[model samples]
Target chain A: MLKKPPSVVLASFRPSTYPRGYASALHSLRPCWMVFLNILILIVVCGVSSAVVLAEDHLAVPANLQVFDTPNDGGQSLTVNWAPGALDSPDVRYQVLVGDAGATDVAALKVVAEFPAHTRLVKDAKGAWWTRTAERNWHQFTIRSGKAVELKDGTVYTVTVAMLKGEERIVGPLLQAAPTPNWFNWNLVNNLVLTLIFGGVVFFSIAHARRRDIFLRRIPGLDAVDEAIGRATELGKPILYLTGAHDMSDPSTIAAAVILGRVAKKTAAYETELLVPHRDPITMAVCQEITKQAYLEAGKPDLFKEDSNFFITSDQFSYTAAVDGIMLRKQPAANFFMGSYFAEALLLTETGASTGAIQIAGTDSDHQLPFFVTTCDYTLIGEELYAASAYLSREPVQLGTLRGQDIGKAMILSVIAIGILLATLGVATQAAWPQYFLDFFKDVK
Target chain B: MDATIIGAWVATGLTLFIFSFLYKDNPLFKLAENLYVGVSVGYTIVKTYDTVIVHLIWKPIVENQEWTLLIPVAIGLLMLTRYVPKAAWLSRYAFAFIVGVGAGLAIPRTVSSFILKQIEDTIRPLLMLVPGEGVTFSWNLMNPASSVNVIIVLIGVSSVLFYFFFSVEHSGPGKMVARTGVMFLMIAFGAAFGYTVMARMSLLIGRLTDLIEYSDPSYGRPTLWLTLVTIGTLIVLSRRSRSEPPDSH
Candidate 1:
């Protein structure tokens, strides 16, 4: 049908038969005044509403919703991640909903966490770049064992995300995830790489030392070992040795035990008495074996006493008091304090000093080093304590290990120099590259 | 008297006995020392039983049906095999396992936290650019994170590390570096020694406070009585020692 001319239509806008001017004008514009235009407007409004209803029903909420066990973790954790949607903003509310596996009803799921959509994004996570599970533009929420959630390991759970914009709530697809314990945390790959490098360096050094002489600077404390032993033999006084207050698990304790072997051998050869008092029973047991082996090696098995490496109490001050008693009573000509010591360092060393014994101490405990140095005639500080066994034994393996550690320190020094230079230059030039260099030394997890 | 008051009296007497050792090795000091050793060993045994046996091994196996706890229990039993000389060789298995696992765990963690983290912290930028201003070197000594402190740390770390380098002998320039390292070490040790002296002084203050508290009339003046007894005992012991032959020791 042909539409009416604008002039006729305007002229037809007049008062109707029933009402006042305003209502009559509105009445004339619809119904028959402009039939085709009115019909077209109705169709457009209906179509738009229909399309909106369809979109609300079918369009996915919080795009690309995924659920998986949190990686690089022990277990009992599940992560829900989704791509950032248009609705994400500071004003909009986002929530993490978790339920038993195969649970489809969103109403049944408990909301573990709820916050503004702009927070908890992938970029907010701490650690190295590779530690992030998703790209910067995604939102991540973790469900772990806490007051809000108790996710059991190896049990599947369904997870979903919900977004609230005003009164409208959109729920995402239900996804299943199981919290399984991981054997190795991939986040510490950098740590693994460093350990491997150091291991390779150590092994290579060991091999090289076996082939040729590796020059190790003289450690005076280690050099004094023999002199101390000889002094004990000359005085006819028993040599008193303490392995400190750690178990056999500690590296310092192990070194002390090895040094005990060397000392025991010399003591047996000289037929000078040896007294070793231990705080840990396990260490006492091990040292007994070491002392026995040393005597056997020196062909003085008959002189080796089972009571020599005896267990004292594992108490710090009590053990120190007991050792002090021994020092005063027996009056050992020489005192060897090795391994890690605590506050009792001064108590033992001072007592030994007062007894006029030739005191020699080797320990990595920096806090107690001052006491050892002040009271003892000879003190091995820091790594020197670790190197004492190697220096005394002169064995290829021990020598190589020392050389390897030295090389490792050198490598570390080189890295520090290079990193500082790069970092300084980056700051001056306003470059993004230096952080990558720094990240190499950063602990990933 | 109440148990707390009695405990105070006993503690005061023991403290006085121990203090007698400062004068000379006497019977009182020896008695106190032996008692201290005995009580500490007893405490350790009880603590080990409670923690290892009841909590770690027994509770888990009974409550949670955690059979995995048995493995560690078995290993611990293997460690006890050392008492049997013939079976003593078996204890090496336990030791080996412990050392291997400990080293494996320690190496990675040490590398991560001790080595890597320390290196990262040491290698920081000497300069920083402030917004709307040019690059700047912070000279604020009060701020530990400032560039001046950073430079000091750099020198300290490098010199100390160089000193520990065993392969290179401390000679010529190496000797200079080693000397610088020694200076730094002495400074560090001196500072630590002073700090520890303060700590020890505090400990002494704590002990003195206890002694003073025990000397109150409500506690029956245990500290004063104990001190008199200790002094008398020391004098008698010294007299006896002087009377004895010099070759008796």
Candidate 2:
């Protein structure tokens, strides 16, 4: 026969119903025994009820767990997602667990991520699913933080999502995923499409440009270049040109080289002395070829000096010091600071300014634009530097590239306009379609 | 007496010598400048040898037994053929490979990071001011500052893009938009200039703080001693230049 606990048995029994001898003995012990028994009963009742309440509070396991390799990545990540259980509460959280594939032991799994409850709602969601859903509830919680960095590529992994309340947890069924290296990232499909479209437009424009004249706007900076060269010629002083601080690989440096060709041709025609100092050896070699070509094109190849384009130290400040020395000593009538520059920009420009040289600078470096604008007589800001090269060269390919860039900008503007209109319509009428229309612009990843 | 103190003194002297160029391009400034250039070139050569020759090429091939790396190693060695008059054309192959690979790699990344990201950022809804909030509009327009900012940004981006459009001539209405674009560009340039000025000033403050620290007695007043020596050297060089005849160009 089973016996109840001492506290429960004591509560059910009474001393009065016992025999006279037993009753007399019990009377003496009744006062103290009843007090001790009452305290023990209270302690046992509280402890048992609290444990039961804690067991009841344990959250239900998350349902419909899914794991897969993250698409359009370098095979370094996996995404785990789960649907919330019916018993999920605000106080409960979900933790994603990862283990080797076919691993059934929950204790062996490692927690990859922990997500607080009620955090599944898309706050700034522009997706069609997010907009169309009337309940405004997330269908599944996506946990991208479950990336297995140490896991080898092509190795399979199992994932589980556990609903947690305090120390108690209930884990969902395991899901398997394998990360494999992808040759091409499909996530950047929009980027690929735009690049192809833009590239096609450029090639078409280039072909068209060869057959006809392309109308290019008057860049004020190009005229200034000619004027500065004329001023240097009239003053019987040399014209100084810098091909910036970058190597030949930089786009800005290439543009600078193109511009240098145009300047060299004019200088050769005028028979004005030209000095070109370079910071990069490769750029120096390329500029030498460009200068020689320009002189040959101008039919003044004999006047081309090999020493005109020479390399200075590649150290930024040292190069700046050398250029500043040239500016002070040579005191060139015209100084051209073209291409990219950093903090040393102001240092060189300030020295050029002190020499009273007619300075013309062109650069896509916005940070250096201010110093050039204040110190130089004429400044080509940002894209104008690239534009000046195309304008000067009148190359069909360069012109075509510029035209393609403009078209790309137009496409972006049209997209923005459509997005704005849709957003306005969505807000005014409280409809889902307009919001869905805006979803195309959102970066899904 | 200590090596660190001597090093600090030397650095302080070199710094002061370089700074003396602000007074005039003297011989001391030239000395310091040349020293900096020589040190920098030497450092670059050592680093390039370690990274390119030792680590990237030799270690991978020798340690990992990656014999396939010899193809790139051969291509790299071909670049040195430029120094040989007869085999100079061989370097063109290396240049072509480098330029081709660089362009192929850069085009996609540049399109994604610069072009697409810029377009994505610009394609935001103009009406939605605060993030994750309903579209806000005010009759006063300026009452909600964020809406006004959004309008300004949209206008700025459109006008600037219009300015760069070459197909259309800027004649009547186009000229007005182009001029507005110029104004925006100028404002951006002005802001950039202000930022550069702040950055330069910060650098100046950093240098000045170092000078002040070096002037402390614990460092044997290296800055003060270096400043005096640089001034004396510059003065002597200026006197010598005055005494000599000017060179004919």
Candidate 3:
């Protein structure tokens, strides 16, 4: 049964003791009470301010919204202008999306215009057949601010704007404006081969899950984890596990935590010391719980040390440095790195190498893989890191998801093959045959 | 050189100095590594104090003027109480709060992102492919090139999603679909793998290219020579490891 949280306001507090004559006790108590009362007063003030801060959020838009006179030297393209949205401030970059009403339903949805808020040009797309007039940065684009759009002068159209900030996608309340669709949009080919390939893998995994015959290529990096832990036990040195700097929200961090569970169990069973240094407080707490559970499962609950998994500063390089310091001082015989890593990957790997520690690393960060592969004894690449957790846990849910992903990969492959064949034939024929392929693959904003 | 220019040169020089480890480690690399460690730790301390203590803790009380800060304060204190082995159970409350909120945020977002959005996007308007004119699979609509591409994309998307679905059994037609999904997945993974391999190899090539370019200068060649010498020394020392007397405890 879950316990209800203690009510913050109603919680009891024990007053500190003051053993003395009544007069003296009263004198000392007066100051304590005064300080407590002052703190209470301060809390009330702070509380209101904090609430205001939370409520102070407003959509950030750019100050300058205007039209650019630059015409497309080639054709009917008109330069649309707008200032950045206030929400992004000076730090965020934006994505520009353009949608047309005559297009498909999804296309009619307000496309991200300038996301970072700095882009100033958009080509006019209205034509006589579509009969839509171009509108500027108005709520409803009808009048093409001094710019003439060649549309049947009487048709109505609507246009809207949306602001994108980082990963936070926010569409501005729809601004209705009329805009004629013009300019040649290249036809884009869907990524058929890639899709087929993903599909195939997922299918086979699921099929095999039933018959229990799926042959997963052995990842040597995974195989080495046990050996690394054992080596540390033999050497009487602690085993250090570094979960990537990202918080628990990142899939990579979750993968790292899952891996930690396995490593913790091994350490518990072997009676070897395990150390996990975390940069995020929440990740640290989760890891501590996982470690404790692993030890408990291994019948070594008494040996689990809460302090073994602790939070370091969240700064990337500092966390790296602190781990390096730990490496130098404790000289852990084995080191495991699993999760997202960045430039500091090299620094940490080199330090481990210098210490002659056996290191195993797994991460999805494409940029950092090279350093890890060269330095670590074994490394899980890209998606394989995610797969490792699913593989180890063998929970039905994880297995099911893995099966799905496999299918996605297989589907991707088939489409690629088909696309290649068609493109080759079109080229051989020297006709408009392959034009369809080229058109379908064209990128739409 | 002006001081600023000299500083730039110094920083660049140090970067190159540390980067030399790809060839072999030396005292220069060690020095740069130590400096990096020191500076990085200093930076982290400032960030942590600012973010966790000042913003999360102090600001609520001193600057933001909030009584509700007491809730977080109490939770934080509860977290610390876990250190006391006797009262460790109390720590679960904080954990529950953090985890519950995190889950609340994650479930909706993940469903929207990975499941709903992706799935919805996959179900494209199939009618768009049908020719408005004559039938017989109008190569106009059925441009073998684009048609094949769309079909492939449809197959990939469908199979991949199908593979992930746990409720249904992948048998008969489902088996075929699932198998196809796996094959497609492998190809995609293979392509991704190939790309990653190329990327990593490129980095290695880049480093080597830089080293080769550096060797063109007289000052740089000596650095290279020094690196080679250090590597040679390390190799000889490593060979003597077995024969060396054991350290006295």
Candidate 4:
């Protein structure tokens, strides 16, 4: 400025005079500074544009968000369902968020469950009409959250689904629902219907049986009971009866007790020694009374020894060991193992088999049935264990129950046949109608 | 000696004593059996006291202020009245309540679990061959499960169910079905027997492993010492019994 320097020099120059090398250094640094500034501006502009693109690229919100109380529950669960949006990809996922219905900020809500994309809906429909009308194409995912997730009965909750694609998220509109307790679940209507039908059949059969005589098929095992007792009487040895390892409360034990009464009466009539050992005290007491009553009925009350039905240790293996010892020592002519058995079944049956005892066993215990079948002279498999009481007692009431059970089984078989036919047709034709038949047996809820 | 080592030794001794019954019933086995019974009974009593008396009865009534719990307590106490000959009849009330409640609870669960579930599982698609893919009719020795297996199951189930139909006489075709049912039953039993044997062998192996662990130096080889002692005792007892006269019943 002092000596009317050039415009370029004036623009680059500071107020103070510089050394000779400084001007050249300043000129070189000026170009570097301009380049750095240009780069910084470019980076800022690109970052802003990228952020806008990211926000715009987010997936569309899921449609038809619905919330409702879970049916057939103890009023502690809520179900969240939503129709999936257009965004379907491997990288996409959905998360269910739950919050108080009155909450102002959706972002503050808690994420209850997260599911991968294309989660299939669980159908809660029954019968042909419902199955036909059900949505087949649209994928609607449902999530059930219970009280364990802080969901309470009677409290309204707002449920929303969020689709997550990469780092971007778009949430659907919230739907409000409250969980209410139901005394009778309509979802279990099929179960109720079946039960009532079976119960009514049983009752009707029992009533009908009282008025007329019914033909009964002979059970081969029942035919051998008297023969086994007679063999024991001839051998001058005691008859061993085990009511199994269960308490009196078990149905098998009740059946055993009933069968034991029949056996006791026969033993009492023949004057054959009877040995009954029990693992439970209650069962022992009940058996003692039953034996006494049997003896009384047989007109040989004095033959019913009080010591016959005695309590052994409640320990499983220990009782088995004791029974095995008795089998080895007493060498009972006939051994009757009735009711339920477990791991000790083989141990007991094997010991009895070795002692040359005529063994007959009946049990509903499928696991131990093989042991009984192999080692014992005869075995009553599964339902035959239940049928033994009626077979031996010949009570009208019991016979009616058995007949009703048979009818129920017949109904089940017919259903199975129909189901199989429908399933085959469905597979061959690729038709949806067969699904209605299959859905009848399905517990949809 | 460490407490844990002593416990291992005791356990090993008891296990060997119990196992000694395989030779013959002896005093040692009887002692072990009685000890087991005593321990189990004691444990049961303690558990009952904790669950029934303390938690269910006392805690709820006192801590939770649930005074209505007395009704159940009174009913439970009545169950003990059976020991008193004069008031024995009173126990029937408790028995009735228990039986009624148990029956009410069991019926629904049994229907759902046993009956309905079994039917649902049985009603499955029988044919698995694809239409356009063409049938590959090769016998897979390793995997017997196929459409044929489904047919076999259906036959087995229906035939067995038919056999149990007491209303139908086993005269004509019924007898044939019943015989087939019997064959199926036998096969099922054979498989179950094989599985049970495997299970029992596994239990034996587990016990043998425990015995081996107790044979370690830290346990002072309790299994070995116990085995020797049990064998010696059994020998002595057998010799004594052989020397004595048989008791007359």
Candidate 2 lDDT, A307-413, residue by residue in tens: 99987777898788888888888889999999999988989999999999999999988778888988899998877888887788888888877776777778778
* Worst-scoring 10-residue span by lDDT in model 2 chain A: A126-135
Q: Compare the candidates by lDDT and give the number of the best one.
A: 1
Query: Model 3's CAPRI class?
Result: incorrect
Model 4 CAPRI rating: acceptable
lDDT per residue (tens digit) for residues A274-346 in model 1:
9999999878888998999999999999999999999889999999999999999999999999999999999
Compose the digit string of candidate 4's lDDT tens values, residues A111-162: 8877676665444333223422225534443335554267677988887888
DockQ of all models, two decimals each? 0.67, 0.37, 0.04, 0.32
Task: Flag regions of model 1 displaced more than 4 Å.
Answer: A1-68, A79-126, A135-144, A156-178, B58-70
Better of 1 and 2 by lDDT: 1
TM-score for the first chain of model 4?
A: 0.76
Candidate 3 residues A187-294, lDDT tens each? Answer: 101323323444466566666676663434455677788899989999999999988967776778888988899899989999999989887877898899899999
Which candidate model has the greater DockQ, 2 or 3?
2
TM-score of structure candidate 2 = 0.83
Better of 1 and 4 by DockQ: 1
Cα deviation at A2, candidate 2, in Å, is: 38
Each candidate: what lDDT? 0.88, 0.78, 0.62, 0.79
Between candidates 1 and 3, the one scoring higher on TM-score is: 1
Question: Candidate 1 lDDT (Cα, whole model)?
Answer: 0.88
lDDT of 1 at A345: 98
